[model samples]
Target: MPGIPVTAPDAGKSALRRRLLAARAALTGDEVAAAGEALATRATALPDLAGARTVAAYVSIGREPSTRTLLERLRATGTRVLLPVLRPDNDLDWAAYEGPDALVRAGRGLLEPSGPRLGRAAVTGADAVLLPGLAVDRRGLRLGRGGGSYDRVLARLEAAEARPALVVLLYDDEVVDEVPAEPHDRPVRAAVTPSGVRRFGGVEEVEG
Candidate 1:
């Protein structure tokens, strides 16, 4: 939710983002709930998540695939969960997820962890990162809201030389053959959809 808005030069990407957001907004509340549960089931089974001690994830807002269920499941399994806090500059800061009760409403009508702030660099310690996206290409390029928050997150990880498994959560249809790519966009290792988990090139294979 913290990505910067796409500019005029990104007209094409902007149009696609609007279309996808509109389609997501069309889902019924019940449909979103069911998809969230199914996505959690599939995501929790990934070996990347299964072995993770610290996972960098975010609270799903609006019609996005819900990370709420997945967050709780990760905590239940003794994993330390980190959620993002939006910085004024649109960069993301980190905070530990204490549970649903620990969440507080913040800017742009989104929920954020109500815990001590962990520096932006804190994400470098993650074993995996569950990214939010409107769509991901087979090449694992994630199309995030123009806000650029996760873009900074990825850059931070790269600067720190962290090699955490980067995973995206989306509905089954959001996995496309391709999306508009940018020079700075980093490829994700995998995507977890309600239908199943899909791995891309350079990703580690998850065992059944």
Candidate 2:
């Protein structure tokens, strides 16, 4: 093992993800809650989501920048909110979010919508897709949790020629200088933080 070089892109990504997750785990409940509120306010006002009729988002677990508030706010605005239901193959199957009561417990400590499965392709109809990430670089490269669920979702959208506004939710500190990126890794259009919204690409120009 001494002579082995561990410079592969995936290795670097795993290390970065661990560090970021550790940092997030250190945040207090109050800190995370406050950030979630701010994110709801800032994101709801963003042009990318302001006119969106359908949004694909997820519920936050642990110390991740909470998406619960933003999801509720989006729903209150008459936006059709969809939540992911993780499939056995590690792919995401989406369903309509019908308020907090409709969320049922799922594996991996996740809360998923208990509505009828809309099939994996349902996400293609969303006007915007909110992704969960441990961190994002200034160039918009996202560091996911290595599950590759969102990767499949992105690919599905691409295959359908669907152009949706891609966004990530994170704490302000999670927006860093750089993150290792690979050729197939697509950059998100923007990231919403508690402080404000960070734009990296043409989020406003993405068509529904």
Candidate 3:
């Protein structure tokens, strides 16, 4: 019998993700914080967010910089924010978020909103969906934390007729030329980094 053959793309992506994670872990808290601030500044300047009312974003974990500042800025600008709640079925459940106090520690050390759990209708009303990923490519492909949670939720959102512009936040170095993409991996519309916001598969240029 022949052994299972690993595809070249899969192997390359695995190696790249490992290297990226290792490099990210080497950064100090202050560095991550500063990078996050810069990324947020660039993100807010994107035209897609100009009239966005409801936004869906994630709570960062570990060495990943926190989105607290961005969330506050959005709220102050009258944007209704939603955060994900990890369900027992390993799927994402969403809830309305007001501030940091609305979040509590959940399973796997992830912070989730403690407010009213919203349904698919609320998600479909969002103007933008900010994704969390280990890495992203110039093509908009996202490499998540080995979990299909975001993919599944994004699929659901699409099915609900929610065409919110998808965006991913990443470090400047995490933006690569390519990433191994699976069928279930939904590509984001744009990416925000310390360098600036880049539109994937779009004609928008990163302004200086």
Candidate 4:
């Protein structure tokens, strides 16, 4: 979990993303699939999601810890799941998840929900948000893919004075000791790994 040596935030983030993405790419398909199942179990059990009516989530692609199982489970429980639709400017526009069949292949190795677009402000109404990230530090600072998509989501929430629980899904090893923090980088409230969920800040652990 050594952070990049560069002083610039963008430089540091680029280096970290390259390293983490390479490591994830090295994982076997079987490993990724198993991790996805475990992640689904751990994520669903989080207390933050207990009574959530609407959840902002994403569809995982390639070596990223998969969200297919988690999305299915959430939908089955009658949770209003919203998946991201990549916008022209790279900002995310959300839409209702109507199961796997509703997903359409998008550029940059992404699968997006094909439902009606719910404007950018839709994320602020979610009871919880499951973010995609390369790694998360002990402080809950998440290292995203540098697309600035989730950054906009967070900024919108802040502007609206929303307090939805922010969470990141990752493999166990992706939870690191530290990651370079920036002024705009928002710390997550919790992280769900294959083993279990871990709380940060003043967040409390979910009881089994």
Candidate 5:
């Protein structure tokens, strides 16, 4: 983690990230499990999700709102789910999500697919992407951990001119009024919470 320079502006994002992670860690195991089930139901109900031919998602680590149920449900329907494998450079390489048994523990507390690497650009072919975040606001701005991993993914998506339906899965409280944002931060298509789905950028009309 050394040698990475931190800017003064990043203080806002760094602080918010810590607070959100703290709140998330307070939730009990039962609470997390229940939220995962609810998230699966609400997320899969979205047309973008229900209709996706391929989805790029991640394995939930720690107390982050669980995505296992949703991932499993997606696979059960024959959707080709992709999970990220963290590269040494902190950029992501993806692989197909076969099942829970197919996941191998990578360092830094991540569970990645043991399947063949599909290369970085494989995400451009996805119909939808399920992103992990500490919070997403009404403006659809997502607050990610300070790692800058997903930021690179979004940049890759943009450079490819891929317009995949960008979505974030979070707890209801994580959907907020606002979070720190920068000029390069692009709004997500929608945010799926345990209670309901919040659409942004007229994404609902597309799903309609």
Candidate 6:
């Protein structure tokens, strides 16, 4: 007989996320390209991008598909881009980004910007922020890589009364009804999937 079963909800969800990440990484080249195209297209149409003076976006890494095209497009529109730097204290340090060249390999083998190190004050000035996640829900809850780095940064943003629009990027199937949100989890305002953007926790109806 099998050993006494363990059935913690959190444990089950963690297992599911691991499986999902593995499967997502196995996506075909065509699938990845299509998804990237869709994300870029929808991002261009986002209302937040129209007048955003400052924007913060993550530099993609690993099996994570590239956002080079999207970043280039955003830069062309004159939106200031800022990238996150992993600090030793487990918090995020932001830096001004001019282009791809500003990036250098950093924490967890991810590429990060090598520009002027800005403080949390710069994050508060941003009109929009693009967050990274393993999965997300319509409620704006995100499942990150368990670093708590983003949560820490977002918490600072919340305390400042300058709530920039938070957007999480994910694959289409990664958008679900619910995700296990911890007490310290910082909720986003919306999610951008391969199909389109969904306004999480918003009253406005989302159009496909």
Each candidate structure's TM-score, on Cα atoms with residue i matched to residue i, is: 0.91, 0.91, 0.89, 0.91, 0.91, 0.88
lDDT of each: 0.87, 0.85, 0.78, 0.86, 0.86, 0.76
Candidate 1: TM-score?
0.91
* lDDT digits (tens) for residues 140-184 of candidate 5: 789898799999999999999999999998887776667879999
State the lDDT at 2 in candidate 2. 9
Worst 10 residues of 3 by lDDT: 1-10
lDDT of 6 by residue, 38-107 (tens): 7877876888876798888887765564566678888998888888888888888899888888789886
Regions of candidate 4 where Cα sits further than 4 Å from its true position: 1-11, 202-208
As a whole number from 0 to 100, the lDDT of residue 105 in candidate 4 is 95
RMSD of each: 4.9, 6.1, 5.8, 3.3, 6.0, 5.4
Candidate 5, residue 158: the lDDT equals 98
Candidate 3 regions with alpha-carbon error over 4 angstroms: 1-10, 202-204
For model 3, residues 1-208, the per-residue Cα lDDT tens digits are: 0111224654576676677788789999998889878877877777777679888888888877558778877888888889888888778778988788878998999988888788645667789999888677656788887777777778888788778999888887777766778877777898787777777676544544
lDDT of 4 by residue, 72-165 (tens): 9999999999999988998888999999998999988899888899899999999999999988876789999878899999999999999999
The regions of model 1 sitting more than 4 angstroms off are: 1-11, 202-208
* Candidate 1 total steric clashes: 5
Could you tell me which 10 consecutive residues in candidate 5 have the lowest summed lDDT? Answer: 1-10
**Worst window of 10 by summed lDDT in candidate 6:** 1-10
| Higher-lDDT candidate of 5 and 6 | 5
